[model samples]
Target: MDFTNLLATEVQTFINQNIDSDINRLLLKRSSFPNVTIQEIVQQIKGRKVAQRKFPFLLNENIIFPPNLNLEQASSQSTAEYKAKDIKGKSFLDLTSGFGIDAFFLSQNFEEVTLVEQNPELIKIVEHNWKTLNRKADFINQNLEEFLESLGQAANDDFRKFDVVYLDPARRDQNNKKKFLLEDLSPNLLEIEEQLHSISDKIIVKLSPLIDISYLVSELQNINEIKIIAVRNEVKELVLIIENKPSTVNQQPTTISCINLESDEPEFSFYINEEKTATSEFSESLDFLYIPNNSMLKAGAFNIISKKFGLKKLHPNTHFYTSEHKLDNFPGRILQVEKIDGKDLKKNDQFNIISKNYPLKPDEIKKKYKLKDGGKRYLIFTQSINGKEILRSV
Candidate 1:
């Protein structure tokens, strides 16, 4: 029998019965079902229309669909949380509405939402999902360039004015390598600058967490805030907010804020300029060194971090530095030196080693030191003030 002849109920039951089994593998093994394709199975058995297989076992009811419409694990929790906090009754536009996750969330905030997607397949899926939820929205299936051209031609009164504009560009190359910076994406950003500037008062861009925050801050003009979002202790996304109007008044010094969503306590807020003020001449006798977190390191405000905590930079770019005293609220691990002999490390028992912005890998150093991994003691292998190899502990 042809696959389409199989009732939706039968397809749903098949998916429920073999939910744990690899459908692709099963299909490959059973060559007799020649007409049943994987995509057909996905379309017929998954989603709300099919009651038995609708839940997919991996998603909560709040998470209506899987990320990218793939059966694999989703990237984030449902847009419900973000929707509860920021979206409501505003005019919103999703400039790059891939999979419509952001559009779905932003829809909760705005009464009217316009989702512009270039891919026809994705736009169809988004439309289907939006209709399933029964949310009102305008789904525009057009390349961003063409859409912007049409928007520009419309009179000011006829144009759709958005309170918030969201953009999440395709951050991957044709070969599937990740694009770290905005300029790396296709269709050139310059063309959209004037168009983007004219359309919305507030713009939010979702960027790859792997990117250097400093590079983004320097490159993107009119940015009001940068949020490093971590979900369940894992950094997920970086949100950059740019205001339409740049402030004419000189603002307070820029600060780096780290929000630990996992922690019960308040967010960790550090002043970068204050950290820059704390910089001192490096002294070997200094008791402790403050290491900034990986996010701060990626931000590359070494001078600011050093001076805020009154620490001295070991080297200009080493990212490791020392301070005479200790700070209760230091952002990164605080290593207190119990012993400082590199020669002694070679002779000691095993050491649990970690390397960051340092030359040598842990295994290479472990083989050289003849050390094992397990330990209560934490050892940081890094470069010192003179650019020499050193070991320190917290």
Candidate 2:
């Protein structure tokens, strides 16, 4: 797994030149650097290919990439950069430094940082890459438990007490089976709660989006905030911020921030209590329909969204909103409507079709009606307050 020699000047140049080269064909050709195998070159090429878009800054920047699985698991440059802004510290620690993506970004904010990883090879890789970028970080070749046990022996004893101890626990078990339970995740965050608090007053955790936020709030004592981070309306990660002090269920509700990184969408922030307390006034069909972005829907602020924008819910459980007046700064797509004949959905074959609480899904409707997706026109199938199923297009 030693790739230090593969990073020679001539080898890197070849990789950069053939970044788009067909991998198998390039592999068959003669190797310019006899010391580096064709397979190693392919790894470099494949890595850079992904980094070019997912991690634009790291591409062609002498950064060593891990295997395919590691690259897949590593945080995207966008998410890493976004989370970096939330962290504040003179010093911080990454409990499980996979490919050092998060650590690399966190280094920009923290004066001192510690990266703890069990894999010695990955430790060496990131250590070299960090040096090339003129960034200095203490890399510890140890597992999470070992690092926590030896926190007293941290690189700089003066900065032992970190401003934040960040961790994205391995959600897979020894068998590589995905586990959603917090107890199943290792370094088992719940098990190390006390030790983590002893080292740092604040901790930032990244969890699978599938993990229940309510379950997390019940299990962890000090949940200061729960952030749902999404890119392009696609939910990616659920970040939980916890403090050292004990907290109760009756304490102030967790602030759920539904953040959509898409430039065109709005970022919505609200409390769970707000959504629970508000009651929506149902309406029959209206002039416009508003659909929330995935992040906002994931945050479950259905009623709160309607209340905030002076919109009325279509039905109690439909999660569709309508208004006679268009709202500015809406968090989701707002479409002007004209009711369409359900039978002629086939006639309008090339329009964006959406369905909520309808008998047929968008795909089913498209397949049955011989419709093609996308265009200026918008078609929505939903149920109105009067129990009438409405199919509207604009």
Candidate 3:
């Protein structure tokens, strides 16, 4: 049977059976295969065949697509789950809705949603997927610039206004270089803030986790909240919240929230600048050491953390601080100091080692300490405590 003559079902079956043969790699390697046309191949595999065959395996079983979508750009289930929570019940306009994952999920919460996509093919796929899910949304096939311009005109006429304007800019070039820094973004927001600010009262911008949170906050003066979202304990996205204007209470403290989506409990909540927490200070030394939560670290709340946790900053730039005692309510890792070894872990054996905010990685520390991976071990290696100290539980 000729390969091209096969029915869609048969073609999918054939592809599935030979997936182990590296068909994706093979398809890319052949010069005669149309690079631009492979989108159809992907849509067929994902939309119809995968939907039918792997329906049980998917998290969002309601949404389906054609074989054309570049699965490489498909948002992960975790990101979808988080977006569902953040964008719910708010009138949100997605400025650059690639594949419509964020828009689709956010639509669940809001009375109305507008998804703008510049790519015609992606817009079509998103429409199909939305229809499959039986969800309704306004899909605009216009560039972000044009959409923003229209919104600006409407805003002047008291027509277009959104509670939230969502942006997840494409953080890659045609060559796929990682673009996480604010200055590196395309059609750069730095250049378009005036127009963007006019259309929306609040903006929620999603950024790559690789970005430095400090740099982003510094660049976007309107930002009021910074969320470091982790799914199943693995950090995924950094959400920056920017408002139209300052709040009525000028002294209202900024919040740095850490969300552990996979947790069974209420997800380890804490207030960074709570009045009581602001004046507190760490005791000089104690039995256990408490590490402040990741959001606090990302926020660079060094003074607040030092006071709240009663810990001392080990070094100026090193985020890790030292506390002799542990707070029962602290949200981060707690370690019991066994022994302090400086530049002599090489001579020690049977020690389980872990490193954080330090020059060396976990594996490198393991090799140096001559220890094996995994256990309820108490080995800690950090550069902040006066240049590479080892502390293990007694």
Best by lDDT: 2
> On TM-score, who's better, 1 or 2?
2
List per-prediction Cα lDDT, in the order shown. 0.61, 0.82, 0.62
Specify the poorest-scoring 10-residue window by lDDT in model 2: 244-253
By lDDT, is 2 or 3 better? Answer: 2
TM-score, cand. 2 vs. native: 0.93
lDDT of 1 by residue, 125-222 (tens): 66766765677889999998888788888887436467888887666788977677677875445457667878886777777778776676577666
Worst ten-residue run, lDDT, model 1? 54-63
Best by TM-score: 2
Q: Report the Cα lDDT for residue 244, model 3.
A: 72
Cα-based lDDT at residue 242, candidate 2: 85
Model 3: per-residue Cα lDDT over 6-91, one tens digit each:
23454445445543454466466433333324443444444544434323223343333433434445455556657667455447
> Which sections of candidate 3 miss by over 4 Å?
1-75, 86-90, 154-159, 181-183, 246-253, 263-285, 292-294, 309-326, 340-352, 356-369, 383-389
Full candidate order by TM-score, most accurate first: 2, 1, 3
